[model samples]
Target: MALNETHDEYEQQDLKRNLSNRHLQLIAIGGAIGTGLFMGSGKTISLAGPSIVFIYMIIGCALFLVMRALGELLLSNLQYKSFIDFATDLIGPWAGYFVGWTYWLCWITVGIADLAAINNYLMFFNDGIAFTPVEGAMISIAAILFIMGLNLVTVKLFGEMEFWFAMIKIIAIVVLIAVGIWMVVTGFTNESGAVASFSNIWSHNGMFPQGWGGFLAGFQIAIFAFVGVELVGTTAAETKDPKINLPKAVNSIPIRIIIFYVLALLIVMSVTPWDQINPKVSPFVNLFSQAGIAAAAIIMNLVVLSSVMSSMNSGVFSTSRMLFGLAKEHQAPQALGKLSKASVPANGLYLSSVALLAGAALQYFVPDTVRAFTLATTLSTILFICVWVMIMISYMRYRKLRPELHEQSTFKLPGGVFTCWLVILFFIGTIYIMSLETDTFEALKVSPIWFIILIIGYFGFYKPRLKAVVDSKI
Candidate 1:
């Protein structure tokens, strides 16, 4: 399709480019920093030891390439609203259908996990007030509604909320890094008698303390931390200047990985040996509490709460947009494509919110909420891998079919098609790593059922209607 032709077609639709450069930047930042890093890192460290650092770095590098490919595609065709759009145009409508709904399901699961996380965080300040899982589920529903309300207001309001949310996360990481450095430089000792020192990283049974199996286990959870990084690509339709702001957001992935993941992990391990880091509590809170700073631990908890909220907020926004995009392409009900007078996809937003709320109710059914949440998270990560792999495949196809566009594009992905293939291999390896663990392997076993359902729905429902519409148009 011609660029102008596609542009004109979407111009008739109502979604506006209201998100500013600052919003785009912060959204990208928020996507990179997830609560998994705060809450899940401890488990990863215990499993992989200090080698978790390399796992994060390796995943970050591979995902950066995924973002680069996504960025190149979005910029290459301004008419394309998001990756889902280009996937359909470049690949096939089946590609769009599968990716769009899978992404929506991905965020729904993430939102469910975040709601459970937020409830657990709130109990920290409950002050002996007993809160049951049902009550937590109620609060989770309320929080989802509140975020949905914000999204219904205006895109600008959504952006503003994200900006502040991202800001809090940034400040929290910076504070943690600074305090960790101080403890290391001053040789501060923890209650456990683990003296602060950079040598702590390697001194405690070497870097790969748990051997290759443990290192492989780290990839399962570490990949979840990077789930939202591709969120920036979803905002392509609403971003002010895709060429400038989008590239800036995509290119900054490395710097974020270095500061947020690598340096943060290095300092945490330095202050407290990897072996001593509690697998249950957050390393951030643990480090401060071990140093006799109760106030800082409270602050870190609050920061973690904010991070979880930010992630859920982004989840709601992206999933709703995916539904809206699906509706526009006739992959979903026409009702979902309708935008309110405020230029928001109010229907799609509500639909996604309802799905998320249903997920919240899982707390009441599952006997062990933590285990259920872990399974949900693993399932979401697997679906995300599918989405990222689709993007890579789409980019490869874009290059082969439209080499002229690739040649003319100002921002070309380095390593081109070769890098795309490498990233695919990296994701496959991560999935293989996930399969080695029992919990994650269970999630992998259950995940394919979702795709099977999607396949059945496509042929049973969508294919006949789509064919009829095409025949009429022709």
Candidate 2:
């Protein structure tokens, strides 16, 4: 097929290059900081004590290498839409099909969790309004439709929304960190006589208060915090100036991790002793409330709500694009490949929104937010790890088959194929750790069902369809 003929296809409609560098940078930051940091950090601190800080650093470092490989691959060929395209070229058609579909589900699951979190957060204001379950579900449906409508108009609007939403999260953390610093400097103490000081980090039971075992346990939840960090790569097709913008966003992962993840938690642990922090409540609100911010809970609730919406927005955008990519390759329904007049994947977006409504349905069915959220997030985490592993494998193949590309590449992955091997092993080890825990283990047990369905679909549907296409061409 000629390039022009390919360009004219429904899936090949050129996505507008309207995402500016600022948009890309904030999107990367937004991906790094998830609702996990806001709500789950207290639990992680209780698990690992002060060592939770180190855990975030280590995970951040490993994922940076993963992003580096992704950046190089996307930049190596501007034509490659996302990691899916490269996986297809270097690994095999099966790799592309699995990764593309899995990546789409990764976002779907994340969106589900985000929607649930958002509804729960909205309950903070319900004391006055007395919001019921039906009302909450209606609000969630409305929120999804609102975001979907925004996405249908322009990709630039999506970038703009993420930028402001991420700014809210960044400001909240910075304010909290500043307040923590002041408290530590003045030797402020809460009602329990626990003085705010850096000593709080190590004074209680030492840094390794939970021992190596607890430190390892922290990885189970902290890993989920980084789930959406690869989101920048998905925006490659719509980004302005891929070579410059993508690398800038990718390389900043470490700095973002240090500031947002490590430093924010460091401040939290410093102001409030790790053992004193309640795992059931947000430490972010705890710190501010103790500091006499009377509206801390209300303020933090709004911040977290925005953060969840930001994540869900990214999920909606990426899942549609993944479906768009899958359809282009004939791995999905051809209709999903069709583009809207605005160049948006409208059908894909609509389908993903329908899938997301399951979150609201889950709220009605499950009712227990904690159990439902944990299962959904754990399943999403497992699927995301699968996608990351495929990226690493594809990178290794890229190096072996296209050594010259690696050689000539200005933004080559450090440690080259060696880093790829190490990252893959790290993910495998993360999975083993997950299996030891009851909640995560249950999700792990259920994960294979998705793959089983995929396998049947591949053999029963995809394989025969490919054969028929080939026969027709002949």
TM-score for all predictions? 0.96, 0.95
Runs in model 2 lying further than 4 Å from the true structure: 1-8, 127-136
Model 2: per-residue Cα lDDT over 97-144, one tens digit each: 899999999988888777667766666566534245677578778888
* Native RMSD of candidate 1 (Å): 3.0
- Model 1 misplaced stretches (Cα beyond 4 Å): 1-11, 127-130
Relative to the true structure, candidate 2 has a C-alpha RMSD (angstroms) of 2.4
Q: Which pairs clash inside model 1? A: none
Residue-wise lDDT of candidate 1 within 1-474, one digit each (tens)? 542344345448757899999999999999999978987898899999999999999999999999989998999989898767999999999999999999999999999878767776676688625367688778878888888988899888889999999999999999999999999999999988889999999998899999998998988888899999999998888888889999999999999999999999999999999999988677988888888997998899899998998998899899889988987777887778777888888898999899987766876665254566678789999999999999999999999899999998987899998999899998898888888899999999999899999999899988986786676566
